[model samples]
Target: MEPLVRLHGITVRYDGRRNGGLVAITDVDLDIYQGEVVGIVGKSGSGKTTLLKVLAGLIRPVKGEVVFNNHKLNGNSFRVGVLFQSPLLLPWRTVIKNILLPIEVLGEDVSKYLSRALELIEKVGLKGFENSYPWELSGGMQQRVALCRALIHRPSLLLLDEPFSSLDAITREEMWMLLQDVISHEGCTTVLVTHDVREAVLLCDRVVVIGGKPGRVRAEVRVDFKRPRDLKLQYTKEFNDYVVMVRGLLGD
Candidate 1:
C-alpha cells in the first residue's frame, strides 16, 4: 500500500541568535500509512517535536522533501488536526463554540458545522456540557473539548503531542481508551510525539525512536497488539516486551 506521507532526508536547522549552530534534526526519513497510529519517542532535545513540525508543514527542512498523497508538500500544508499538551481553549468560548473554533479560523460557515460540532461533543462525552465554559470543566474534560475542536474541521491527519501528559494517571489511562475508541470510529491516520515509552507501546501500531545531537531515526519497533486494548494489557509480558524494546531503542 502507498504511504499517506513520506519524509526523505529531512533536515531542519536553526539560525537565530540563540540557536545559530543547532541542527535540530538531520537526515530523518519516515513513512506514515493510512489509518495507522505512529508514535515518535525520544529523549529531551531529541527533536521529536521538530520532526512533527516538519510533518505539519510548519517547518520547512533545509534538505529533502515531504511527500503527501504522492505530491511534494510545499508551503501550503495539508489539513491536520493537532492536539497539544494544553487544551488552549478560549476563556470566553463555550464548549461547543470552542470545538467550532477551527472552522471559524478557516473562514468557513459556522452554521454549516454546528451539527458536526454537536456530534463531536457527544462523541467525546461532552454532550450536556456544550454550553458550559472551559473553566467549569475538569482538565480531562477540557482536553476532550480540545480533541473535538481538532476534529471538527475533519482534517486529513491527526497529530498528538503529549496531549495526555498533563492529566492525572487515572485520567490519562481513561483518555487512552477514549482516544483509541475515537480513532477507531473516525478511522483517521495519526502521528503521536511522546516521551513516554509505555504510552507509545500501548497506543501506537509502530514506534520510531530518534536520537543523537542532531536527531535521527535510530530504530523502529512494531507493536502487534490487538485492537481496543485496555489497561489490563499492560500487565502482560508481551506488552511490556514492546515497551522495553522501544525504551531500548531510545537507549534510556
Candidate 2:
C-alpha cells in the first residue's frame, strides 16, 4: 500500500545567534499510511516536533521532499488538523464557534459547517456545553473542545503534538481511549509526536524513535495489536515489551 504522506531525506536547521546554524534534524525519511497512527518519540530537544512541523508544511526542510497523496506538499492546499500541548482555544469563542473557527479561517460557509461542528461536539462528549466559553471547561474538557475544533474540517491528516501531556494520568488515559474512538470513527490518519514511550506503544500502529543532537530516525517498531485495544493491555508483557524497546532506543 502506498503512503498517504511521505518524507524523504528530511533535514532542518535553525540559525543560531553565532554564525553557524544549528541542525535540528538530518537525513530523516518517513512514511505515513492511511488509517494508521504513527508516533514519533524522542527526548526533549531531540527534534521530534521539528520533524512534525516538516510534515505539517509549517517548516520547510533544508533538504527533503514531502509528498502528500502523490502530490508535492508545497503549492498545495493541505488540509491537516493539529492539536498542540495547549488547547489554544479562543477565550471568548463558545465551543461551537471555536470548532467553526477553522471554517471561518478557510473562508468556507459557516452555516454549512454548523451541523458538522455540532456533530463533532457530540462525538467528543461535549454536548450541551456548546455555548460555554473555554474558561468554563476543565482542562480535559477544553482539550475535548480542541479535538472537536481539529476535526471540524474533516482533515485528511491529523497532527497531534503532546496533546494529552497536560492532563492528569487518569484524564490522559481517558483521552487516549476517546482519541482512538474518534480517529476510528472519522477515519483520520494521525501522526503523534510525543516523549511518552508508553503512549506511543499503546496508541500507534508503528513507533519511530529519534535521537541525537541533529536527530535522525534511530529505530522503528511495528505494533501488531488488534484494534479497539483495551487499557488492560498495558499490564500485559507484550505492551511493556514494546514500551521498553522504544525507551531503550531513546537511551532511557
Candidate 3:
C-alpha cells in the first residue's frame, strides 16, 4: 500500500536572500504509513521540527515535494491536527470550547461536531472538566484539553512537537500512556518531534534519528515491541538498547 504521506528530498533554509543562509535540513526523505507512530529524534537544532512543519504544510521546503495520500500537498489543504510543547489553550475559554476551537476556525458546523468533541473529552479523561476554564486546571489537565482539541476534527495526521516536554517526569509518563491509548483508539498516523529518546522508544512504532550541522536522517530504528506497552518496559535491557542506539546516532 502507498504511504499515508511522503517527503522527497526536502530541504529547508532560513534567511537565504541576504546571506548564504542557514540550512535547516537537507535532502531529507521520509514516509509515514497509515496508523503508524513515527518519532523524529535528535539534539537541539536537528531540524526535526522543521521537517514536521514541511509535512504539515506550514513550511514549504526549498526543494522537494510533500505528497499526502498520493497527491502533492498544497498549502494547509490536507486534514491535519497539531499539538505543541505548550497546551496553548485560550485562557478564557472553557475546556470544551477550547477543544471545539478548531471546528469553529475551520468554519465547520460546530453543532455537528459537538458529540464527537464530548466523546474525545471523555476519552482523554477530561469528562467532568468540560466546563472548567484553563486557569482552573493543572498543567497535565490543560495538556489533556489540548489533546482533545487536536483530535476533535478526527484528523488523518497528528503532528506532535515535544508535546510532553514541559510536564514533570511523572506527568510526562502518564501522558505517554494516555497518548498511546488515544493514538490507538483514533488510529491517526502521527509524526512526533521530540528530544526524549525514551519517549520515542516507548511511543513510536519506528524512530528516525537526525543529526549533524545540516540535519538529515542518520538512522531509522524500527520498534518491534508488542503493543499496550507499559512503563515497566522502560526498565528492561532491550528498551535501553534502543535508547542507546538512538543516542549513538545523535553522537551523544
Candidate 4:
C-alpha cells in the first residue's frame, strides 16, 4: 500500500533567546500508511511535537519535504485535522456547540455538519452530554469532545499530540480504546506524538522511536500483534520485549 504521508530528510531547529542553538530533530524520514496509526515516542525536548508540527504544516522545516497522499504538503492546506494536548474548548459554549465550532469558523453551513458533529460526539462517547458545557465534563470527557471536534470536518489525516496524556491511567486506557475504535471505524491516517511507550505500543501499528540531541529515527518497531488489541495484550512477553527495546532505544 502506498504511504499516506512521507517525511524525507526533515530537519527542525528552535532558537531560544537564552540558549540559542540547533535544537534537535535532523534528517528524519518516515512513512505512514493510510488507515494506519503511527506513534512517535521520545523524551522531553526530543522534538516529538516539533516533528508533528512539521508534518501538520504548522511549521516549515528548515530542509526536506512532507508529502501527504503523494503530494507535497503546503503550509496553507486544510486537509489535516489536529488535536492538541489540551481540549482548548470554548468554556462559554456547550459541548455540541464546541464540536460545531470548526464548521462555523469555515463559514460553511453549520446545519450540514450539525448532524455530523452530533454523530461524532456520540461516537466519542459524549452522546448524552452534548448540551453540557466543557466545565461540566471530566478530563476524559473533555478530551472526547476534543477528538470529536478534530474529526468533525472528516479530515483525511489526524494529528494527535498527547491527546490522552492528561488523563489518569484507567481513563487513559479507556480513551485509547475509544480512539482505536474511532480510527478503525473511520479509517483515517493518524500520527500520534506521545511520551508513554506503553500507549504507543498498544495504540499504534508502528512505533517510531526518536532520540539524540538532534533527534532522528533511532528505532522502528512493528506491532505484529493482532487486533482488536486490548489491555490483556500489554502483559504478554512479546509486548514486554517491545517495551524494553523501545525504552533502551530512547536511552531512558
Candidate lDDT (C-alpha), each: 0.91, 0.92, 0.93, 0.88
By TM-score, how accurate is candidate 4? 0.95
lDDT of each residue in 134-202, candidate 3, tens digit only = 999999999999988988988989999999999999999999999999999998999999999999999
Better of 3 and 4 by TM-score: 3
- For candidate 4, write residues 1-252 as lDDT tens digits: 778888999998777778875756999999988888999999988999999888778888888998877888888564677898899999999999998888888788999998888888878877789899999999999999989888988888899998888889999989989999998888888999999999999998899999888889998989887888888889899999989988888995
Off by over 4 Å in 2: none
lDDT value, residue 48 of candidate 3: 87
lDDT of 2 by residue, 89-124 (tens): 999899899999999999999999999888888988
TM-score of each: 0.97, 0.98, 0.98, 0.95
**lDDT tens readout by residue for model 1, 69-182:** 999997656889999999999999999988998998999999999998888888888889989999999999999999999899888899999999999999999999999989
Worst 10 residues of 3 by lDDT: 13-22
Stretches of candidate 4 exceeding 4 Å from the true structure: 17-21
